[model samples]
Target chain A: MDLDILINSLRNYDGITRKNFIRGATQILDETYNIGGRTALGFGDDASALDIGNDTLLLMAADGMWGRLIEGDPRWAGYCSVLVNVNDIAAMGGVPMGMTNVISVNKEDICNEIMLGIKEGVEKFGIPMVGGHIHPDTPYTALDVSITGIVGKDDVITSCGAKIGDSVIIGMDLDGRQHPKFPLNWDTTSHKTPELVQSQITVMNSIAKKHLLTAGKDISNPGILGTLGMLLEASGVGAIVELEKIPRNKKVSWDEWLKVYPGSGFVLTSKEENVKECIEMLQEVNITSQVAGIITEDKKLNLRHDNQEKVVFDFNHDIIMGIKEERS
Target chain B: MDLDILINSLRNYDGITRKNFIRGATQILDETYNIGGRTALGFGDDASALDIGNDTLLLMAADGMWGRLIEGDPRWAGYCSVLVNVNDIAAMGGVPMGMTNVISVNKEDICNEIMLGIKEGVEKFGIPMVGGHIHPDTPYTALDVSITGIVGKDDVITSCGAKIGDSVIIGMDLDGRQHPKFPLNWDTTSHKTPELVQSQITVMNSIAKKHLLTAGKDISNPGILGTLGMLLEASGVGAIVELEKIPRNKKVSWDEWLKVYPGSGFVLTSKEENVKECIEMLQEVNITSQVAGIITEDKKLNLRHDNQEKVVFDFNHDIIMGIKEERS
Candidate 1:
């Protein structure tokens, strides 16, 4: 395999390149993101954290599916909407609670399909899609869902909490197939039992409550390595990930596998001693996890495959979300 | 004023009538609204309340600006988006913490104007616009914003809390002009100081913390009387509102004032003994308040002007949102 070709393809992939825009957009709103002095964690995390009274924090996040996907499958768009929001809350180590969505569509049939998917997602995840305003008539189709969750101020796991010497681990369900319509989407929950899917969520909370991980994030859009890059950026840390060690299904190419939006996956960082327990807990719930790397203070994300190393993201010059979420 | 014509106009008004579609839409998803059983309050309230742990609740709400307003003035639409979300939180007697928006626009000029207005609004309300997805290219322009706030478990004030014999209080900033672009929009915050606008939000928290009000809601699309009707419906109660007693800007006719969307306005119900304190608290923030009516056991919204009382909405027969919003 040509390293140059691999690097260029990854750089041009919409999933990775689209993140560049997020960096610019987040910078413009940084000042207001912390207005009133209540924003505990702003951009660079799955959700923004706001401090409430009594050592409780509110985790809030919003996601809008790509228009292409909504046009292709409104039902999938709706289901993914819930899937993404729940992952956001789980990523924060916050107990997933409720969500609200605003969907605008021109066709009732599409709307019906979307709602059906949303209903199934809600029942499976056991989190409600409580209240929202719907635009019944619009020229195009769009769906956006925002969720709110609760976490103890001290127990919350943030993407910015990773520290040097922390072990980088990836936990993902390898028993998934590519969504026929959306190849980049790995549909895992569609085949899993509700109990199993919910267990996947509860385990994340258990890990957080146990104070096992120093930093973590749900794997999303940019996929495994890209997600790790974001967490490293947020924590102001770096890592050297062994590409061969990342859990994989083998049926898909590394390039495609690294980009699929998995149904249940997370990138976590735990101290050297806690890594074993963290992986064991996730594996008990069917999540295949392995220590993929070690966090470092180098400010560079080094990837090693076949003993050939490449810098995926160099924080010295690269900006993923451009927001350094490290609190200390 | 011709009562027939006035009533007909209001019934036909897009602001008042568009909500009629809400019931049909919300019904399809009501089963999922409480899927996880964490949703303490759902549809029809200013915000959805989620029961998080440690006796704290997360309030979430969404609002979409009228497309006509976005077309006429993107800036106003943007500003109103922030104002409306803040009111949603305040209506819950929760702190106006932060907001996220999904904006669909194709024109650069319109997007810039919207952002500028949002920036001004964020600074004015002292709340962050932390994260939102943008639809860069859509056939039409639309804006939907959702906010998350923290309210104590016991301190939350819901629209479903009214009871018989409660004094109905109407609070509004009766010091604004009709928007040139959107005549029905009562523009109060455009000329006010940020300090004053923020204070308007805090006063509601005071009433809630003091446990004075039985129920409260922010005045929205359906206008003052229309909004009051929903609150009464949600609380499983009714009211007899004296039209002449409703607060209004003298310059604007009674009908127009009642229909205008005030920058800061609310409808609250409290026991007779708590009326004075509620009124006093609202007045401190320049929100003119008065005992304009009284809650009753009947399910009819009766409006009286010149002793000729007219039954505007008989919940026993007519439906506003149609969904009874019975939070069991």
Candidate 2:
């Protein structure tokens, strides 16, 4: 594979570029991001956290289906909405409690299809879609879902806790095929049994409780490497990843695999001694894990594959989300 | 006011009609509404309550900005998004925690204005907008927000608990003017100090702890009588509400007042012995409270005015939301 070509493609990926606008919109609440002083983590994490006392942190997150996804396939969009949000909480090592959604649609058929997909997702994940609001006569169709979860205050994993020497591990479930319509979507849980899919989520909690990792994040639209770039940015550190070490499905090419949004995947950081345990725990749950890189202090994400080295994101000038870590 | 005209107008109101679709969408999850079995309350309430142990119930709710509102005034729609979600939790007597949103926008200027309005709302209500997802390029603009709050399990208020012989109390903060652009919006908290606005929210918690209100719901797009109709339907009971006894701002006409969505208003029911205490507590927060009616065994909402009474919503034929009460 040509390292420069792959780096260029990832750098210009719409998934990562669209995220650049987030910091600008969110900055308006900069002064009051922690308005009630209860926000334990805010703005830059998979889920913003509220310190609810009793040693528990309440994790809240939201996800909107891409407009194209809604137009191309409403059912898949609805199902992915639940999968994405559930993963957000799971990435934080939390037990997802429930979800609420707001759907705006002009067509009744589309709304029904979306709801059906959401139902399938809820049943598979075992998280209830408790309540939501609907706008029946909107000019266009859109679905937005938000979730709430709970994690022990001490056990909560965050993107900003990665240390300089931590091993950057890429854990992904490779036993999946590309979605029929949306090829970038790695369909891992849809074909698996509910018990197995749920175990994949709960394993993160086990890892967090045991302090197996220093930091973690779910691989989302930005893909594995792009997602790691966000984690490095939040941690105020850098990483030099061995692209060859990233586990692949073997059926998909390396370039495409790096950009795929997996149904069950994570970018985690752990101490050298804990790497074996972290990988083994993930393996038990069907998540293939690999020590792909090491965190650095240079504030740049460098890639080395087949003796070729290149920079994917140089935080000194480039930004993924442009949001710094917000601590309570 | 002509009783027939008033009843017909409210009965045919779009606000109440639009709600008819909610139950259809939510019912799809009927079998798995409590998938993990921790759901203390599900659909049909202002917020779903999850039994999170430790005498605490996690209250979650979501609301989408009206498409018309977003198209008319993006800023106001942004601010109202927070107000509505906060009130949902407050209606259940929960402590407002934090919120997450999903915004889809094709226009950059509108997105910025919405964020600015959200910032103002967060500061006014003292609840942080912790995190959210942004779709910078969508065909239409929409904002949906979800909130998480905590309430004592025993002290939680629900719309399904109103009993026969209970006093139907209407509590509303009437010291506000109609929004210049959106006449149907009674702008209350925008002009009040943060401390005063917050007190209005806290009073519900106090009332819930004191066991003053048997059931409660925040007055939303459905206005006063229509909102009361929903409460009656949920409780499987009815009410006889005296229009004149309902608290109102003298400046606004009766017909328009009955349809106005006040910024801070609620329809509540309580035992006769607790009416005085409930009203007093609300009055202390500048919310005018009055015993306007009584809950009855017959599942019909009867409105009385000038010694003449007319049925507004006959549950046997009319269904507002049409969702039966979901008890833990």
DockQ for all models = 0.62, 0.89
Q: What is the lDDT of residue A279 in candidate 2?
A: 99
Error of 1 at A29 (Å): 2.6
Q: Write the per-residue lDDT of candidate 2 for residues B240-290, one digit (tens) a residue.
A: 999899999999988789889998999999999999999999999999999
Name the best candidate (by DockQ).
2
Instruction: Give per-residue CA lDDT, model 1, range B210-229, as digits (tens).
Output: 99999999998889988898
TM-score of chain A of each: 0.97, 0.99
Clash tally for model 1: 0
Docking category of candidate 1: medium
Docking class of 2: high
Candidate 2: true contacts recovered, fraction: 0.87
Worst 10 residues of 2 chain B by lDDT: B319-328
